[model samples]
Target: MSTFEGHVYLDHHYPPVLWNIVRGGFDSVGLLPDGEKDFAISVSLASMLQNSSASRLEAELSLEQVRLATTPNSVSRLRGVFVFDDIESISRIWDSNKWGGHFIDEYLADVGVWAKKSTRVDAAWIDDIINNQGKLLPGWEAAAVKYWSGRPKSKDAPIWEVLVEGRFCIWSMHSKEAALKEISAIWPNSLGLLTHSMNCFGLGSLDGQCFAGITGNEAGISIDHYLRMIDSKEAEFIEQLARLPAESPKFFAGKPDLEKMCLPDLTGYSGRICAKDDTNLTALLNLLSQLKNETGS
Candidate 1:
């Protein structure tokens, strides 16, 4: 699953009570989507995610709130939205050579460090939490964790090892220079995952009909541009969907329109691509430095 339809943020919490269902979501299923998961996102799609798009879906990007201090009640949270990933991109968390900054150096690699620090954990975890499980779903549907049922594998094995392993896809590890070059690019995977529990039915929206879930990660451009990109009155479909809980119903349902991925006032809106937080930020900072070539797609 190379796609996610929600918004994510690295949040340093003031209090769980302050955040817990501030949006009113059904966490009874225990699919608390926050932390480590967002880091697995790929740098390849970082720019595209930030760009404007014709197609869209709702997604929630997040990570667990880390407690930094007990005396003063200080905590550290991630500070960006990342929803795409590949092997190389996930590896950037540790290897600074590709990502420009050292994530492990800052984070200390304790979150998902199960036996070792590798993208395999992120990749496997994504499939488990997303593809294998699902978003805002009930408790029963959360499967895929059976792969590791046995604490220590009786015997190491590559179950699906023979699936043409050499067909490797090229990936980028979030280079500031390479990312800035593609700032003008547009996107098809438009989404706005929920940040608060406004709707009652699910952690998403009340009716679970909205496709885009906005939790304030990409600022408000994600939904504002989506609705304003087209004349709400002219496009009856978009107009109606906007009324619901930010869900682009029947939205990303169609294939991507590479040519039509534009909105109004290009210069004015693109500048609001949401700045990345410097402290413990996994993705951000696409400056106009000496541009580098994007490799591995």
Candidate 2:
């Protein structure tokens, strides 16, 4: 086994560079432009000076002599850097007609290199209705339902929900009131629903809310309850379908695959079958029946 060592640093304002070379150093590799190979190698004494931590911003003053002697060009532009070489000098040996196969096998065994870091701004875009709150546009509720079903136009709708799960914290830019309201409705119960917002961007400013939640211990229960609530609502819709003529029920087409659906088995390792075995069509029917009996439908 072989070992390699290196460090990475990141900042906003400049390009990346790498450095440091002892005489007879290891070959350094990096990403190549539009190449079929994952990476390429560059062996230059100047590359070392450009990437060295000793040559960082305002600090290069001390290394000016070394930089001038090594590269003959200003070293201020390169921001990213990586350096690696085999401990066995396998490349050198291979070059001397001592080996048959590539030295990459030995190189892979020794060195492990990683890329440097970079930064950028993140943002989201929200539509007019969600921007104005649920009340901004008339007939928004119907449009929301349609949007929820993936048929949206003109009016705005809530595209994502931000929940606080476990100990996760979120910093909201605006819409704290709406975010708090949604949190109050979901927290201490179902937090997994919040994972969808963790890396969200494009959720527009204003009319949109962002908040953080702490995932509570009862997260599983909360999630189950939330899903059941959705299932119950779907059950109500199915009940309505059962009452309608078969020809009129086409509106429910292409909705959720309730027939093959399976609910979580709260007690066992295997998921519970939502419908009966063999004939998967009865799960929705049984759920509708249960809902109707409870609701006096």
Please list the C-alpha lDDT of all candidates, in the order they appear: 0.22, 0.23
Models 1 onward score TM values of: 0.20, 0.14
Q: What TM-score quantifies how close candidate 2 is to the native fold? A: 0.14
Candidate 2, residues 1-297: lDDT per residue as tens digits?
Answer: 122242112111111110011000111221222221111212221222223332221222212223233432221112113222322233333344432222233222212232222111000111322322212344434433342232324233222211100111112222223333444343423222222121111111110112111111321100011011122235654464444435444222223333323332222211222223312223223322332232111
What is the per-residue lDDT of model 1 for residues 52-114, given as tens digits with 9 covering 90 to 100? 231211111211210111111211111112222233333443343322222233211111111
Instruction: Give the least accurate 10-residue stretch of model 2, judged by summed lDDT.
Output: 15-24
Candidate 1's C-alpha runs over 4 A off are 1-122, 132-297
Off by over 4 Å in 2: 1-215, 218-226, 230-238, 244-247, 254-261, 264-297
Would you give me the overall lDDT of model 2? 0.23
Highest TM-score model number:
1
